[model samples]
Target: MTDWQPSALQLERIAYRQRRARRSTLIAVVSSVVLLVLVAIGIGSTPGWPRVRATFFDPQRAWEALPVVAEGLWLNIRVMLICAVLIVVIGMALAILRTLRGPIFFPLRVFAAAYTDVFRGLPLLLVIFLLGFGVPALRLQGVPNAAVIWGGAALVLTYSSYVAEVFRAGIESVHPSQRAAARSLGLSYRQTLRFVVLPQAVRRVMPPLLNDFVSLQKDSGLIAVLGVIDAIRAAQLETAIDFNFTPYVVAGLLFVALTIPLTRLTDYVARRQGWYGGGGGPV
Candidate 1:
């Protein structure tokens, strides 16, 4: 094959655009950091800051709040891990069912569509409330035994719909030739999908999946509305008990501390994925 390359004009245009993008990204990131620092300094340096600091940093008060914080952290982690696993399995199946062509697929598609629309359309608070408080009246006696169950189930149900679409997109993005070649190699359709299409699709979709997981982690706070002892709820409880907002501030800081690393990791993964031809390997 002959060496082929972009024209000089095209190369120059690409270089200029790359430089512009890098400059814009750098400026935006720096501006955001500066703004955050300014706000933090303002809050910490304001009049009465000493009282607030003393109250918030009190070791006795802090020790008392630790149990609630720990409980909330456990609840948050439990909900996230359980919901994520359930959503991935259920969502992938729904996505495949939605894509498969058949009379059987019709109702599956409708169900998936309706599920996504209903959950995405409604506020998460409403869903959690309905599941936790409202569903008990119908005497749905199987799984929802308590507020936590209903709350976690609602999270899984709502996010699964969104995850299904991600899986569907990933699956469909695989080239038709890959599927055909898999079948031509004497593999069953199911076998081919399992071995070839899905793996590639998953690599392509991993970043978005991680983004959704982060959102899920944050939204896990909404469980507080359902009377679950989530981190935010624990903070609120401490606030109510002590008549101080320090607990809430402490909780906020904890969440920020936890999520900041995940956000940075997400960005790092995205950059590495790009460098590794979108496979998230080696690079």
Candidate 2:
């Protein structure tokens, strides 16, 4: 094998691009700092700034609340992980059902479509309340009605509907010719979907899948409304003790800390797939 290096002209182009990138970075950093400083000055000049800071940004209260909120944040993370897996599985199953061919699948397609429509249209908080409180109100025999359990179920049910649509789009994006080729190779319908279509579909849909998981990470905190004792709930309890909102800010920061990395990964994947757009205003 021959090893080749860039020509002098190519090297010059690379150097030019690096210089431009560094210049852009410096401008962005300076502009961002300036904007933040201006905003801080504007806000600090307001008479209520002192009260707002004392209520929401008290460093001592944040320090005291950190351990409690962090501990509760773990529950939110666990719920997100568990619900993410379930959402993908159930979403894919619904996608397959919706995409099935032939007259026999018509009813299934109808059912899947209806399910997605209903869940997507309904408010997620309502679903959570229904499952989390209303079902437990029945007190069925041998039924465990934990708030976390029902809250997680609510997340899975609602998110699976949206994700099913994403998966369906991916499945449909596969070329019909590929399925014919798989069939000509004596592959059954299931085998064609599993081996021929699904792999490509999944690859195409990965960026959106990561975006969904990112959203799930944030929504996982909503389980706190069900009295799950997750981070938000912990913050609420803390606020009641001293009427300080710093715990809520701490909880929010923790969520942002956890989710930002996944959001960046999603952006990277979207760019890698050439799906990057909507980054600029209309020309």
Candidate 3:
């Protein structure tokens, strides 16, 4: 309102105010970071700190626990791989059944729906218990031990439902024009699905499928609840024996190590397939 130019001193004062504002912002940021670091250090330095430290840094204990951890890790990998293969096979069949439209297809649809509903509705732990305890109570011969039978079966049954839906969606995602084009070439429905629709749908859905596989790998730990001696269980046993937490941390790292490759592979495929562009090409 004064309509007057500032003196040199006023200009200097304005400059000083701007500099002070920047200084205050920098101080706030640095203080917040320092506070966070202090809180983290305080938490880490709590009781049993000495043993936790020794567990990771101690080479001898690490070496001693390696073999046991490796055994459990192997079991985890085996369960995941077996479940993945079974899920792919079972899921494809169910997806095909769900898409067919006819009198024969109706019963298959009902059965697939019930199967998916039952498995997906129940928690994995309950299913594992049924397999481990209930099946044995029935005295079914040729059933292997709980570890082999329950752990493996529950993983396959539970995940296959979700993956079946994934397959169904992928199969349906193929454009009707693609089907028409294939059929125009004298390809039958099954042949169109086998050669044209499924191949493209699968490539389009690879990223999600990989993500589901990773979830299956992590869920393999649920087997330990049924006494399957997976990596988590083995780590707990080792930790109790040694009275140290290092084994558990090491076991956790092993899981992270295993999953990191999968995440990277998913990213690689997503990028290669132009996932940003709606999975337009090969992954």
Candidate 4:
């Protein structure tokens, strides 16, 4: 078959479609802005808006709370960074263990399965509470007694289970033919997995992994319950002293800001990878 080129009419149709799409997008953006403005006006004119504004949107209070909340947010950022690395490592290891084929590896597969089931099913709050309170209560010799360590451990455990499932799904989605081909090339199972399967699996699962990271970012706030004085806790302290909720709002905004870039990055990667049919080009 000769490589067919678009005729003039076809090119014109393509240009028309592009123009229509741009117009639609512009209309949607304008309409959304209008709707938002109307909603803001409606809320601003409400009977209780003054009280609400004073409590939750006070400019001076927000300014006063910004520095403290930002400081506390730094702690959350640190925990998130540490937990993100640990969870990905632990999750990949668990997924690899679960994927092993030999009878000798049965025990490990079973353990990995049980670990994912239990951790993924449990509420994160409960895990945080148990690890934060229970571990320290034991006062084990040489174990760190710090709430930060305990909270970080809990986050790592909870998030790893979820991330493991993502990795497992990605691994399973790879064609069996690829594994067969690798083995035929004299690659051992471990070597095939290391050099072939895992790289593709990780690429396929990047978007979901990033989504889980966003969840992890928000859940990092839960560490506040352990009294690690993260952003949320800092907001709570300020609110308690001032009898206003502005600080909490500020803290929430900070968290939102932190996650926005990650979310955008996820979308960008997904598009580049042609995920959700958002085909930027060939993968």
Q: What TM-scores do the predictions have?
A: 0.77, 0.94, 0.78, 0.91
Candidate 1 C-alpha lDDT tens digits along 132-190: 88877788657456777888888888888889899999999999999889999999988
> On residues 134-232, what C-alpha lDDT tens digit does candidate 3 reach at each position?
777877688666666677898889888998888889988999999999999999988998999999989988988898998888888888877778888
Candidate RMSDs in Å, in order, are 7.3, 2.6, 10.3, 3.9
Between prediction 1 and prediction 2, the one with superior lDDT is 2
lDDT of 3 at 35: 100
lDDT of 4 by residue, 1-283 (tens): 9999999999999999999999999999999999999999999999999999999999999999999999999999999999999999999999999998989999999999999999999999999999999998998999999998999999999999999999999999999999999999999988999999999999999998999999899999999999989999999999999799999999999999999999988888888677866344322
Assess each prediction's global lDDT (C-alpha) against the native: 0.83, 0.94, 0.85, 0.94
Give the deviation of candidate 2 from the true structure as CA RMSD.
Answer: 2.6
Tell me which residue pairs clash in candidate 4: none
The digit string of per-residue lDDT tens for model 2 on 1-283 reads 8899999999999999999999999999999999999999999999999999999999999999999999999999999999999999999999999999999899999999999999999998999999999989999999888999999999999999999999999999999999999999999999999999999999999998999899899999888888889999999999999799999999999999999999888888878788867674211
Backbone clashes in candidate 2 total: 0
Model 2 bad stretches (over 4 Å): 1-12, 277-283
Better of 2 and 3 by lDDT: 2
Arrange candidates by TM-score, highest first: which order? 2, 4, 3, 1
Worst 10 residues of 2 by lDDT: 274-283
Give the best candidate by TM-score: 2
Error of 3 at 1 (Å): 71
